[model samples]
Target: MRGVGIEVNEEKVGRTMEVDEKSVSGTRFCLLLSPDRMRGSLCLRLERFRPRLGSLPGRRQRVCAQRRSPRARRETSPARWRLKRMSPSPAVVVLALLLAQHPSADTLRVPLDYTSIQEAIVAADDGDTVLVWPGTYNERVDFLGKAVAVVGREGAQVTVIDGGGSGPVVTFGSAEPPGARLEGFTVMNGNYNVQLRGGGILCSAGATPVLIHNIVSDNVANYSGGGIACLGSSPFIIANTIVRNRARPFGAIGDGLGGGIACDGGAPTIVANVIEENIAGGTGLSGGGGIACYGGSHPRIDNNAIRHNVAWSTYGLAWGGGVFCTDASHPNITGNSLLENHVQSQTVEEGGAIYCFDSSSPLIRENAIRGHTSGSGGAVHTSNGSEPTLVLNNIEGNDPYGLVNDEPGVTLCAVNNWWGAVSGPYHPETNPGGDGDPVSDGVAFAPWLASAERLVFVRGWPEACRVRQGGDLRVELAVFNRMPGFQRFWFVTSVDLPGGASFGPLAGPTPLMLLPDGMMSGILGHAIPPDAPTGLWTYHASIGIPPHDTLDHAQFDFEVTAAVQRLLRSRSLDCLFPSP
Candidate 1:
């Protein structure tokens, strides 16, 4: 194929030309014109003679030469037609198909085998995926400015960052829209595990929220939250086993708080996690053996197994064995099993299971508490005018050292606790009462203390039940009437008598406070008024035999037919009714 360039010269149009390269390149048409558009009338005439060139100058060569054309008085400028070989349509279609087959989320993937986790993070663009492979990257990683998803393969031990040294393992501080997501990795060893402020792993005031899962354990915090710390951020600590993290102070008052994790003022959800064997050791004032909730931080500690931890006198004063909620911080302590927790020192003021003070009312209920020890409450204690501590369904063992409430107006109303020696107002044997049928043969009826095992017998009497005139009369009744253990007895009475017949100075119900014998009796003396009328009168009485420690009810009915019968009987009754 061949082509030629016929330069056109006209007065109004610049020296312009057209090139048709179908002969040399074997396809298509070509065109070129002067660089200057002004005085462009002459350049338009050159289009009439469509010239072609066999070879066109390169772009660099076309700019160098420019001359005025004499033919037809044309304006000359630099613009040339350059042509090269072009590919067929079938070849262009094949290249686009290859790129579409590869997988990508509007970005690229970088492996951790050859590069560092921080290097992959920094090199990634927004919306890219950095697939980290299996290996330990023993260094602190910070998500510099990328809003990318940095994930690792499952069972791929790719990025194993430690707390051995060099500050927090990962940090996220950026102005991106929606922060970041961290999943499928084992994060351990650091002064603090994952610290982020807003952007990625927030440690800042308005840094973004974090979602943590899959075992964050054995981490230490010099201040609080040994496993993870969300300073002012609210993170969702969901379904993770946070175990054995210690928070001890090296400087200042080492008031260690929250061994497993300490959330300071940040309202995070600590749900369904097993927080145990965690110690908050202090040299001075420590709190929350398993988890400490302080500083007006209201955290909901629900449905977790907080057991076998020690919040004791590690320092001068220690408190909160299983969980410590103080400082007027109202945490909802519900559905948690707080068992076998110990507050060893009397100097540790409150709560073997929980210590509440300073007007903080935490809802403590439905928890199985046992084998716990402290100065006051085996279960719980409150003080500082913090009235109405709601405690319900907590099991109390006879802990020699248990919960104590020293403040006035502190009401601890406990119910349904299963221990023989529970200290309260009601006696264990007297509860589950049987109306005057007191001989209950249950194990709970045994002596409350080992030293005093007094006999409690069933008092059975007053069966028919009728009385009047204050039932001032006395009667004697006995059961197994001559029992040897019951050597002494007393008369107790109830009567229905007319108003005129007065049983003067009638016997009281407990007049015979102790009846040592089985048979003993007292008189029911009556005074008949001189002008009294006739009326039907009935008398009933019973005997309380203290030896048997039982009441024997016997009914004795008699009608005072007339006033004369009572007057005559009073004189005759002296002979029949002798004080027995």
Candidate 2:
């Protein structure tokens, strides 16, 4: 696909891939993708043996962890990763996959080796890597189903792919694999004139490219998928900011589709993304301001923040301001925060957050659907033989009702949800004194939870290991919750030294609510006696609520050399060299 760079500029940052530190200093590091050598699943680093002659190609080396400088750590906010400071994007390990080192495949640079990005892609092979510098390219690009990787030199902030108000900015049509990626660029100014769908990007014919760490915004489509559209393709869309896109229908009134992302018979994995401020403008019928799944698609939408999107039907009806699924689509909606989304219409507005129709059965679980507004179903609605299941969700603070079912003989299996209060949702015929949000008749709300866990423990790792002789080897767990929710959690860790001595049941200083989208990172660690052991220190760290419920945990080991204030680097490279 399109993205990744092998540039040698300091201010114009390349994708800082982490390779093993063969030497401490006086070494040069660069990354490359060689499909014939790296087994099509790994990225090989090209360490320049002679740092003075970096421009000339020399012998290649594959060191695992690169040394992180203070400036690099400042550029990337979090120092959680032991490898060279990764980009601040979520799941930085999965950004641009420059797979196996091929001897023949080269790193083609935009405006350096080639004039444009499409020319580089055309002249490239399956194992090639196309590097785009930080500049606005006013042309369209297609992957051509090759295994190439294209990455922005300075990430998405400066690297732009503007379509110049023409067709889709990017297209992946020919069935690419998972390793084919498009990363680190801002895609905008895409205007699809005809009803062909996919204003910003299009993926069709079973294409499965990994689209991560990019900004897809300010695009307009005549039909569906204003930001990104998938027709019979299952792309991995992760950690991208998708905003300000629209589906206008060319001043027409009636269209039922997605504004930000639409999947037509595609089972795409959409995770860890922020989809906001997208609009579906129509009159009679419209759906999904943030996302739409129809025609038997089964997308996995997990751990995303979908807010402020609008499904507007000028004077008619609309459904699902956050997500809509129809025509037998069965999406797995898990661990997401859907807030402040709206379904706007003068007449009817159903499903302020989610809607299912015509046999669409989505598994909505572990999500916080809050602050949505609609006339009918404020949280969710089901109709026309749809049998959706809702579990472990915090459904609260919507305008009218929490759950509504329009079709007869179709009971929604909505159970074990927290409805803004310990007393559960307010139902006149069932629980009149319920202090939570309101629920309509024919919707199940029993077996509900007293309180829901506010944050999904995205992941946890040791930011640093506090080590002092005879003191404690305390591990700090930095937990990042991407959703706009709150929960108080504490920490405990157990360390097993190299000599079989046990240390800790160590606890954090105080418990605090990890609140409101990256504001607070939780703490977890172990207190090990440093003077006792010297070989290998294995630690297990965990974070949890006050009494019970371990939210997240990480197990890792750090090497112990000599005991004379020696620095120990971690050997466990799970965060660095993940399984292919």
In terms of lDDT, the best-performing candidate is: 2
Ten residues in a row with the worst lDDT in model 1? 41-50
Question: Per-candidate TM vs. native?
Answer: 0.48, 0.70
List lDDT for all candidates, in order: 0.43, 0.68
* TM-score leader: 2
Error of 2 at 487 (Å): 4.6
Residue range 505-579, candidate 2, lDDT tens digits: 433212333334432222222223434556666665565654445666556665443435533222122331121
- Candidate 2 TM-score to native: 0.70
How many residue pairs in model 1 have overlapping backbones?
45
Superposed on all Cα atoms, the candidates' RMSDs to the truth, in angstroms, are 45.8, 14.9
